[model samples]
Target chain A: MLLQQQLDGKITEQKDTGTPLLQVRNLKKYFPITSPFGRLKGHVKAVESVNFDLYEKGTLGLVGESGCGKSTTGRSILRLIEPTEGSVNYRGKDLLQLNQREFKGFRKEMQMVFQDPHSSLNPKKRIGELIEEPMEIHKIGTKADRMERAMDLLKRTGIREDQYFRFPHEFSGGQRQRIGIARALAVDPAIIVLDEPVSALDVSIQSQVLNLLEEIQDEFKLAYLFISHDLSVVRHIADEIGVMYLGHMVEKAPTDDLFANPLHPYTKALLSAIPIPDRKQRRERIIIKGDVPSPIDPPSGCVFHTRCPFAMEQCKSIKPEMLQQSDGHQVACHLYN
Target chain B: MEGYPLLEVKELRTRFSSEKGTITAVDGVTFKVDYGETLGVVGESGCGKSVTAESIMRLLNEKSTRYDGEINFKGVNLLSLPEKKMLDIRGNEISMIFQDAMTSLNPVFTIGDQIAESIIVHQNLGKKEAMEKAVEMLRLTGIPSPEKRVHEYPHEISGGMRQRVMIAMALSCQPSLLIADEPTTALDVTIQAQILEVINDLKEELNMGVIMITHDLGVVAEVCTRVAVMYLGQVIEESDVDALFASPRHPYTRGLLKSIPTITGDRSQKLHTIQGVVPALDNVPKGCRFAPRCPYATDKCMTEFPLLETLENGQKIRCWHHQEIMEREAASDVITAAT
Candidate 1:
């Protein structure tokens, strides 16, 4: 009651396009390990002090290898998992401070689409009911209105309305992903965190899904937090790309700038390792020397120094801050300094 | 194309008996793998590329699988070989590696014991000799500090090192033929590159005839000398790696190549995708299997099946309208270049 009273009438106010739709600062999510009996063992710092902003209709792509906490970062932003420390500012309001009942009101504008569409949807529910369940929970419309809106969303997502009555198991992987996208858009969300949306689909179906996402983002001006491991897919959709390594945002730059001028040793190694489709366009591959260090007791100072080819003695002892490069690009490596 | 191949598979058909019926996973698959050459079998899942590999290895259970073909490995017919003889040839003359090393390697045993077990079985070496050779094999796969890693279990090592351990076990006996099925699929890209480089280097050192099975065309372009594109149960197209990418003869192959987003190409355009998904294995098509999703499919394609015919440039295609495909692709090439 006090939180709502503090907000008063400003809760529903819309901000101008000049401001970022979402601003996250010093975000961290550390899972504490417990001993078999009861005592705290250690901490798995899955995500540590990440910061970024998403403008209206903008997508910030997060790229990293498996177990790098890209998925954890996305989940933390939506408060699916409680953050250890950070401030998620939405139009000047701090989301981290919101209580359970207060955050419920913000759920309409913030949603997430998971990686595996097969497991994300309820197997028993019809596609129409699945898409309409969100609007019904939020009480945005009546039964009839929700059904009509569900049909419209089905059409928008390129699924036929007649097929909406079918169960989840009846549809193919790509079609199921489309239904997943429609469900995310059911409550008219301003921002959606898509976690490896196309990784499960085939190459051809992956393109179809990516094109649909681009089209929908343009139509609704939706801000997206697209997380994927494939650099090729991330470059096509994201305006700005952030490279994560052992829970750290090692590099951040515009998509074109990141690919063309990768400064971080880990980022450069990742780019060079991607296998080119064309046989003739050959380039030297910089295969990192060793496997990724364990996140439990990650290498001190810099997590990537174990595999980095250009690691200096300072990288082992002193941690580097995310320092600014030219024109919004940022790199967290001692070589840049 | 050259002298006698180290291994040749002809008219290879593999069928599994299910509750529905007997479904032929690989039908009339024919290919030749030369010494020191890598032949990439590229396809989507359920496309029988892995079945082709397993069929050659005779790894599938004979009670459930019925195979019809001649898998001649250096003048020996693998199909008609005795069980004892086949056992002798499995790891000694030919070897196999799987995709997920975590599941493939035994968790209870140390990496050294698992690798040494193969050497003991194949080379008839005793415990001490095989253990020493296991370390040497692990070192050959580029595992650093092989002496220490030899005592570690599969779970203690990283995924990349586990994959390298699997490779070490597979190559310990120095088999002349190695069949690697998506060996690097479970690793990260940099680790995948390292594994591929190691595989290529070993292929040269051992002069092995490798049948590399994977779904990645990029991996195919990087390491494969020749490529075979598989559809539901057959090789749809086969050519040199350069030629297959330059002028893909089959519609499915061409569509597969175009669907992947290329780093060198323009990002403004949407990818060209095949219209439909792969048909179910139970519902084997009556005619050209890919006809339903192929744009240039004709009435004749729906009724008559095409055989694999060798093209003028040593490329092989299994399509009735090769002439039309050539013409249409050439015209589209000019259109794309003009734009």
Candidate 2:
């Protein structure tokens, strides 16, 4: 009875309580390509008019293939890179409007865990120092308090407190990811954008980190903008999933719904390609016809039209708008029309 | 000995004499690939899947590595072959495709020239004949407009196309066996399927054996005739594709199978994730390498490593309590669903 009571209390605490944490509207980030003369010649349309609502204490999985601008979208939300266009509202305040001083305070509420731990982490600094530096920069607590917190965070992330003094080289890939997670948690951010956090880790190690993330999210009441290329991992963690293709969210649905009956041809094709482990029940692989179109000079109209199996002539000339085809299910395809 | 395997590795052990110590990447791993069959080697990173493939091709740096095993290719022990003789066997009799096609292919050279080089090196063909053969190989791999694609550099083509080029080059010599190490890891699913289909088609055409080393089980089901599940430098489970998937003997293999999100199953449910992390090479557990993470691990399992035991119908397993574990797992699933 006592254990049941405790579980119920934890479950209620895990429920989202705060207002919508982030609201991105028609966001676009175009990185200018420079010429040999060091002048901005052209732009790479990385994130093109992507819109999504991230509720407080809720995870939103942003999934896409490489060069689909998923990472760019994550970075743009944090203003880690200035958006080329559109508005990002955090806690009802315009994030782009914040100046250097305001942005510093905003940084405390939001943090990012990168894909590659070694590259993101300071090679020279100890793991303890790495975790401490964030707290130090933000001036969260006293020196002794910060050190204690760092040790606790390390333990929370499944890393040994004794290894705090060791450099990044001393740890393995999974341990390094723990250190990365520890550093992200040091800030005590309300939201953490995990960009392919477990992609670099082994499958077994991936489960550990994922389970850790879920446990920590429950304990800390944290929200996540989980971005990854892996659909299976995303299905395990994400409540709501948005499928990105060539800088467009072609489909957005609840994880189960999307997987069960994907409406969009592109989404169906993408799902078909995932190698399920069952040998007896084989799925007819709906191979997308061509590679992802280059973002530099994206095709006019539907970006997925070139590869989509059911692409009509209308799809090639007119861009389809994201529409609510069902309850909480949105798709951007002419087939629905 | 009467029915000879196309390629057989007997007690294969590849060790690297690093400054720290002699680290054995592939230790005492034995397997076989018969003609017109696909052997899927599945394991996580550093589990020596790629290393096993590399050792087969003798691609590992010879200066720092030591090989002790009989790699019998068509009855000849490749480990004892001279460099020149091994070279004759390498591209002529057996070919290998790497993970990254861009890195494997030279950027400056056209696709035709690169593939022609392999044909010229391995076979007694003139430049024109080699170029023509390269086009035929490209066509065989399902590269549309091979004549035009042949003139393009590695950078000019797409990633999938680049992989097709690599396959074309590999099959140009019409090797009896082909080693593909994560050939589609860098490719998208649609492209991966396309490349896989091309390989499958050519295998049937040439009667060539293929060794596909991948972490993805789905790929194995799609192409492989047999599979060997590796864990911590050992083949923990090996069986036919059907039996391996139906009733996986190893806990790790079962965990892997369950962890995968299948479309046919209840997509609403959470993934049956394996509980722990893959231990690092240096910190590999003593008894069963998977015992630490395994749910059904007993004291015997923790203290003694089980040898690969042949089960019903030639299926091999390296687990102490596989039967008991499967029963418990099945019961647990039912109990959980009821609740």
Candidate 3:
């Protein structure tokens, strides 16, 4: 369906083809390190020149280690943390240029679900009121309408109505996470940035939450930027996967292609590092030596050259640009060149 | 005594009296660990995996915690040992490495000093000789430049390095038995792989009987010789790592295995789930603890508890309908293979 908009007092019909729900380009977030006296020492480049396009009703998974800046990329897109440099284009609009009052309108279109559900949900408020509070903040509906919507959302997310009046402390970890999902859906967001949504849950509960997320994605046609450190969980839910290392997007590809033929050496090592549960299928693992380097002073060219198995002389002096290998496969490595 | 296992825990029942009431955290847990063998105790949260490890060490508060079981180390009953003698056996003979390496290590002391202190206390070594042994242990764990790294404090090193240091300290005195409780849980995937490799190499070198307590089945499959699956406060199934993965008898074990999203698993298929949450300790069910979540639970399962029975294959299963479940599963496997 073409959306008709009144732009400059004239009606214009815009086609939805080739328009991504969200586009992040050259995203860079650098936290300045300072001494106790407030003198700027240096900058810890958390995220550098990361780019991706998230289409509507699609899930893009971002996988990385602890300091690889996957969570920073997700938060920067939602403006939860201001980017040092980059543009977040939401449906052809630059969300970064918008002021607080103007950005409030787009906030309703995008919501975030934090990693720890225990700290994310308020302990004092009843579960029902917590879900309705988001709608109340956005001024979307009346008190009774919000209550009705909240109750409906709770039931849809597999929570019983009898527990609506209970506090967050009374619920289990899985149930609290379900309540978090219910609250995120309260604002009717089109794109939800889920940062390690099920990482804290047990295996059985993690699967239940994953199934619930898939069902809601189909029913509401929502897009997700699923950020997690678990590759298996990401492979099951995400359509496309992006691997990041030391604040750079080393590779991005369709889930099937990435798993079948990973291009980057880091990606290969990460895939092999996962301990397969089956005893008969122990693949030869490429164990990367040494820990990740400090982001404050990342390697001169490629941040991964410090521990990369196939690092060349050129890899130490010149950074490899992300090159498209196939239709939807991209890799940043000198081997491809 | 010469032919006895390195460590054997018999009917290990651990209870704690809290403000609410008394709760049996680890009930009737029995297992044996032999030299050069790693026994993995896998379970979900609140399943008494950690408590079992702590009870073996007698680390819990003696005032509130009560124990009624035989924890035999080298054919000696540890439960009857006095606190003074238990202190001598705590780290010298049986050492433990906790999940969080940061809190387990002393922050104020250098890693070398901490390692040396253990050696001096246990092996009757001088300060300089103990320091040399500490650096040697760090080098054995594959830490680069151990001479320099030994001077660094716990906070100065990275998480993976800290974990390696913890391993170095735990293995410094050449303990016969090692109890690692989720040692790599706080680490990243690649780092976890490295740590597991280090542990594997050290276990072979020392010929130590290792008890690995974790919730990750993948870790168990990688490093464990035998696996024991725990539910609530009991071991639901115990078998060799290969056998447990190939054909898990208990319904809870099957459900847990199916729930894990493996990289090689078909993405289109929905994951299998256990129906409900684990019952609280105070509100535990009267019969089988897993009956509420088990799909094959019958009326008999709700009122009667099943004993842990050993099969012909030497695998232990605690389920009344394991034979029926195995037969049905075999039939389904045949049908699927035919298709």
Model 2, residue B226: distance off in Å is 0.7
Candidate RMSDs in Å, in order, are: 5.7, 2.8, 4.6
Give the fraction of native contacts in model 1. 0.63
Q: Write the per-residue lDDT of candidate 3 for residues A220-263, one digit (tens) a residue.
A: 87889999999999999888899999999999988888999999
Docking class of 2: acceptable
lDDT of 2 by residue, A1-337 (tens): 8546534543343244456778899999898999999998888999888988877556889988888899999999898999999998988998988897888999978899999977988899999999999999998889999999999999889888899899999888888998999999998998999999988876767767887887788688787999998887788777789999888888998777788889988888878888877787786878776678889889889988888778799999999999998877999999998
Q: Model 1: per-residue lDDT, tens digit, A76-109?
A: 9899999899999998889999998999889888
lDDT of 2 by residue, B261-327 (tens): 5546643344577776667676678888899988888899889978888886899898999878879
DockQ of each candidate relative to the true complex:
0.42, 0.44, 0.51
- Looking at chain B only, the TM-scores across the models are 0.97, 0.95, 0.98
Which ten-residue region of model 3 chain A has the weakest summed lDDT? Answer: A5-14
Better of 1 and 2 by DockQ: 2
Q: State the TM-score for model 3.
A: 0.97
Please tell me which predicted candidate would have the highest TM-score against the true structure: 3
Ranking by TM-score: 3, 1, 2
Rank the models by DockQ, top first. Answer: 3, 2, 1
